[model samples]
Target: MRFIIDVLLTGLAVFLAALVLPDSAVSVAGFGWAIVAGLIISFVNATIGTILRFFTFPLNLLTLGLISFIITVLMVQLTSYFMGSKFDVANFWWAAVFALVVALIQMLLDSLFKSKNRD
Candidate 1:
């Protein structure tokens, strides 16, 4: 299903971010941790993230929606917490960069998958 694919894509994005960012790392357990982090992120994004975004709408508008990127950073940090020792982020700034990379990867993967399905 699309949901399952989205989770997998999210996991892949996280895994890739870990590889590219020195400020973040994944456990030796690897894929399992990545998948778990991805699931947590997706769940939090759907629930808490939505509410937070709604409440932050004014800030989001004032910043021309740049605040959404900060929200994404918070979401990633939340995911990192649930990951326990399985994943780590150096700090808030690092988390922001890491989340941005993951978001970019997810967007790219989604577009690719959608195109493949279309064809």
Candidate 2:
């Protein structure tokens, strides 16, 4: 149940990203694929993103977390590649926008859920 909710949230994040970033595109096939894409994206972020963040921690600190934005761009690019033709984005800037929007939404959702779970 939690996993399902997480996936749905991820999909919502992606949908929001698509709205914010002109370069990003998702299939209109419906919310189901969005959820699947979200699951894949979450997995990629968990595994690959963790490793990247660990290795780039020094740079991240040096840049005062600005490097995180670049990392997010990379993640978006990687996601675009993984989704192939179904999901597309124009450029790194578009990825950056997507990352920014998604991060904001995800942070909000996390905060909401965390507070509830604590209760």
Candidate 3:
């Protein structure tokens, strides 16, 4: 159940990223690849993202939350590279916007599901 939910969330994130990033494109091969890529991305974010965040904590603090945007952009680019996809983000700013949109969509979906599950 949890695994399925995770995959769905990942698909949603990918879809959101694709929608926001003009250069980001997902092939119709199947959602399976998307789910797999999403899992890999999640793992990378959980591990590497933690370390990067820790190291950049000071800079993040100084920037007053702006650094997180940069972090998300990096993660997206890394994910694209890992998947060997042609998801060309225009720049960091576009990546940041994509990340923000993806986050918002994921959050909304998670919240909706969680609320229903609690009922």
Candidate 4:
């Protein structure tokens, strides 16, 4: 299904982020763990993130939508916490940076998938 593909792409994006960021910023011990963290991240973003974003809509508007990045960073931190040793982020700032990269990758992948679906 499309959801499964999305999760796998998210995992690839996480692996890419781990490779791009400095070792201290983010690290995934293995591909399987990356996939697990990715699935959790996707689920959290779809569920908890939706509620948080809805409640913070005013703040997000005030910040010209930049608050969404903060929300995403928190989601990534949550994923790291839930994943335990499998996924690690040194701190909030590092997690923020990693989240930005992951978001960019996810956006690109989403667009690609959408285009493929349309075709």
Cα lDDT computed for each candidate against the true fold: 0.79, 0.71, 0.68, 0.87
Candidate 4: RMSD to truth: 2.0
What TM-score does prediction 4 earn? Answer: 0.87
> What is the lDDT, from 0 to 100, of the residue 55 in candidate 4?
98
Clashes of each: 0, 0, 0, 0
- Candidate 2 is scored at a TM of 0.78
Give the best candidate by lDDT.
4
Error of 3 at 98 (Å): 1.6
Candidate RMSDs in order: 2.4, 2.7, 3.1, 2.0
Q: Give a tens-digit lDDT track for model 4, residues 25-94.
A: 7999988888898888878988999999999999999999888878888999999998877899989999
Q: What's the CA error at residue 39 for candidate 1, in Å?
A: 1.1
Candidate no. 3 TM-score:
0.76
lDDT of 3: 0.68
Candidate 2 lDDT, tens digit per residue, 15-108? 7666555543433124665566677667777788889899999999999988877876787678778887666666777677667777898888
Residue pairs that clash (backbone atoms under 3 angstroms), model 1: none
Minimum summed lDDT over a 10-residue window in model 2 is located at 21-30
Relative to the unseen true structure, what is the C-alpha lDDT of residue 91 in candidate 2, on a scale of 0 to 100?
74
The worst-scoring run of ten residues by lDDT in candidate 3 lies at: 21-30
